[model samples]
Target: MTSIEHITLEVADPTAARTFYSTAFGLDAQVRLRASEAPTTGFRGFTLSLTVSQPSTVDSLVATALAAGATTLKPASKSLWGYGGSVQAPDGTIWKIATSAKKDTGPATRAIDEIVLLLGVADVTASKRFYVDRGLAVGKSFGSKYVEFAAESSPVKLALYKRRALAKDAGVPADGTGSHRIALGCDAPSFTDPDGFAWEAASLTPSA
Candidate 1:
């Protein structure tokens, strides 16, 4: 029954990053982290997929992000996968605002229903094994193309995809440099995934 307790992202300006995410996505500001030294610069091969219940929620969130200083990577539109778009936050982290539900203009709460931390792995099959070995249960799979892990009590859903395929899906280039700038809070002993994504054990959980 493992789950992602929290996600930490390194930002040059934690205060501003926190503000942008909080205002745009209703994410708790405390999740943002400020490194004592300069953090790496460039694209991080991952995305925070905020899943909402209503179709209109996707548009609303995308609009809120842009107005709050995010750069649009993709405009809101209907797609076979769902209705949504992608954006790079003020701090350079990517986010995908989407919903699988049918189009509806009904009101939605600012709080996100699910936060999926999707990693663009060099090998999806290998990455899936890494997490499973670390205690996350397999939730769904599509061979090497995609895989999802079930979270216990944690709200964040962890998933993996082929690095290049993921970039194409998000309409962005695959090239990246320096740190991925993402971390996961889990019950497993602290370790880095094959692609260098770190997982920090939650305090309540003992080391394996």
Candidate 2:
């Protein structure tokens, strides 16, 4: 099955972005950066999720992000689904750090268990079909609302969500245009999805 190897975010300053990511998340290989002056505004049609083991880890990561110049979109807190919060990086990418466990299992560590890339699409059904035809396997489905793909051996998991709902979840407005300012690096051949998300064949991306 096709799997995401890493995600590349087009930023205005790759050097600063690399420093921010390294200091905040200590990410090296999983997230890559490229210099781009692409005009993008408001919500960028997607959010990267960092899933950890417990609430304390969520809090720790969030704090580190804030210290690394990430502004808070939503303060970390407990919810029905667990604990999570949204933060916008200095480069304007939204990241949601969360965990299913509401309580701390142990001491806090910045170990991220999973990285999920959620695309906000206009039509979930149509997008699902687009990916399924491209050799992606659906791991979870909830009718026309949401779908999660089984990305085997990938550093990132892929999922689809309705644009408006996704924006609300990310604590941002639904309106956005110009560029997604992001691209997915996957094992499959290059293709652009219906919503204009560009995916390319997996390749090694050096840290900026």
Candidate 3:
């Protein structure tokens, strides 16, 4: 099965980004950073998500991220689907930490059950076809609005959303240009998706 073995986020300050990610969410091997001067503005067209076990864990992770210099895009709150919030990291990457369980099952452990990368695409149906041709099996989908690819043994799960809706979900404007400043480390041969997000061989990723 296809898997996203790693993810590389290009930032202006790789050193600071490394420290921030490690300190804020304790991410290292799953997410990597490399130096880049790519010109990008407004929304970068994607968001990283951390799915935890319960509401308290979501609150704890959001609080920790804020203390580590993340800016609040949305305060942690209870929603119809669950409790969650969005925060932008120091490197301008938006992260949403959330959980489906409205109540706590145990003490907050800061454990992340899954890491998801949601790409904001122009056409969900078209982009879905692109991945399907490259061996990604659709796990769940909601018409043209959303689509999730099966992750299997991968460390990171992949999903697609309309550009505008995704931006709103991240609490940002739905306009952006230049590079996505992110790359996926995958098991398949290196290729660029229809939306321009680059996917490369997992072996190219640096050690965390």
Candidate 4:
């Protein structure tokens, strides 16, 4: 019953990363944590925590990556997106470095949780039945092809549409580039809609 608490991104520089994420994603820079304010345990909201690496460590990381054949694509720079940087792994995998400015204020005290994943499917009725038959409880209808499924304390919403239509809405090529599945938590079974988009459920476990 492990739940996903938050997502963290390691950045080359803290101050630059913070400024970039705040500007690019429209995230607020309300919370700032000093070294003493690090968390001990439990769930917290989506937060951007910064740790300044020692000079030697930073140099070693960059050297080791380059020696192993990583290409420096975007050298670290202070941009509108903050201090942005990227490197291309030997296999052509691009790694981006940026700081996120979101904070997780812990779990919701009220009855509901926030929407974690948005799933798009080809057929609404068929997709709804797939989840319902699998023991997921369906809530009120969201729209023509959208429905809500309650997963214990967590809530999952599914949006149905043609594959092409969804791609158009997202402004990404429908060519099936990138990932077909998105993970939820550690133990939760992965789910995919009729159109092939995958979704994972995030919730508070018993321990939390």
Candidate 5:
């Protein structure tokens, strides 16, 4: 079964990013700074979705992230889908905290139940096909608007959405170019997806 294993976020300051993630989500340090020659001016077209067990947990996380220097993109609020919100980490990585208050079949956790890499792609169908061809099994999907890939042995799920829609979801502008802020760690041979998302071949390292 295909699994994400790990997800790397390119940031201007790896040390600061590592600190922010650790403080905000109790995630271990796992960021690599961009080379001096690399330009750091793109949205990365993705958001890290952290699924928690309940609404209060979502609020607590959003608050923690904000206190840790994350910029609030959307304050925690309840919608028909559930209670959640978005924030931009100090290093510019967008993080989404969400909860449906549903019981998790996965291991019980007080804070984060799972982490999902949500990519904003120009062509959802094409990108979906790209991963499906590369061994990703489709989970729940809604036409070309959104799609989720099942996580087998991996703790993180991979998902795709229309670029503009994802921007709206993250409460950020959709217009972006250059390096995506995130990278997928996988064993499927390093390759770029149709929408320009890169997957690096690497072993999984579970975060704290």
Candidate 6:
């Protein structure tokens, strides 16, 4: 199975982008590269390098956005966090584009280090049992339906919730259908719960 490796975001500048992310999410920048010096292909650290489009194309896109009354918070700059930058849209949305740090390659020694994903399900108790029966250990349960599953050594937590309720809390439409699939790793087994939520189980390895 293929585990979720990383998440990437696109932004206007890299330097200013790193600052915004560092301040907002406490995310550390791992690498920085200029538009001219960025690789044309392949992955850099954990994040895949971005493709630099032409200046005229970028300018036109920016101008069009500005014409629509978009405000620019930080113009753009190269910083410690690799490519892309940060911008605040007129609607107050803050965006950042930068290389995500590679997962630490150190030994697994922490009690908890990361949260993989939260799943929305129709029934919580049923879902928890489904996972528990499949070899996952159920942690503290919040009431009857809300629960968290602790994956051994990965610092990843599997969260189960009511679908419509979760969607409402997230300010999104409660139209999501079917179970979401989460890939684990090679040699580890994968299982889908009652509500159709899928998870892959495997031993942890040092990330780079």
Q: On residues 86-171, what C-alpha lDDT tens digit does candidate 5 reach at each position? A: 99998778999999864334543446788888888888898888888888999989998999998877868889998888989999
**10 residues in a row with least lDDT, candidate 2:** 199-208
Which lDDT value does model 6 have at 116?
A: 38
Write one digit per residue (lDDT tens) for candidate 6, span 60-90: 3334435544444334334354333333333
Candidate 4 local Cα displacement, residue 79, angstroms: 30
Better model by lDDT, 3 or 6?
Answer: 3
Q: State the lDDT of candidate 3 residue by residue for 39-96, as single tens digits.
A: 9998999999999999999988888899989999999999999999999999999999
lDDT of 4 by residue, 48-110 (tens): 112112222223344444655556755544444343344444322233333221222343111
Q: Evaluate all candidate structures by whole-model CA lDDT and list the values in order.
A: 0.79, 0.92, 0.92, 0.38, 0.78, 0.40
**Residue 10 miss distance in model 2 (angstroms):** 0.2
Q: Could you give candidate 2's per-residue lDDT for residues 1-208 as a string of tens digits? A: 3888899999999999999999898888999899999898888999999999999999889999999999999999999999999999999999999999989979999899999999999999999998999888999999999999997888899999999999999998999889999988877778899999998776644445
Regions more than 4 Å wrong, model 6: 1-113, 178-187, 200-208
Q: Which segments of candidate 2 are over 4 A away from where they belong?
A: 204-207
Better of 1 and 2 by TM-score: 2
The predicted structure with the larger lDDT, 1 or 5, is: 1
Better of 1 and 5 by TM-score: 1
Ranking by lDDT: 3, 2, 1, 5, 6, 4
Ranking by TM-score: 3, 2, 1, 5, 6, 4
* Model 5 regions lying over 4 Å from their true place: 29-37, 102-110, 203-208
What TM-scores do the predictions have? 0.91, 0.97, 0.97, 0.36, 0.88, 0.41
Question: Where does the lowest 10-residue lDDT sum fall in candidate 3?
Answer: 199-208
lDDT of 1 by residue, 102-178 (tens): 67757765657888888999989888887777678898999999999876677688889888888877778898877
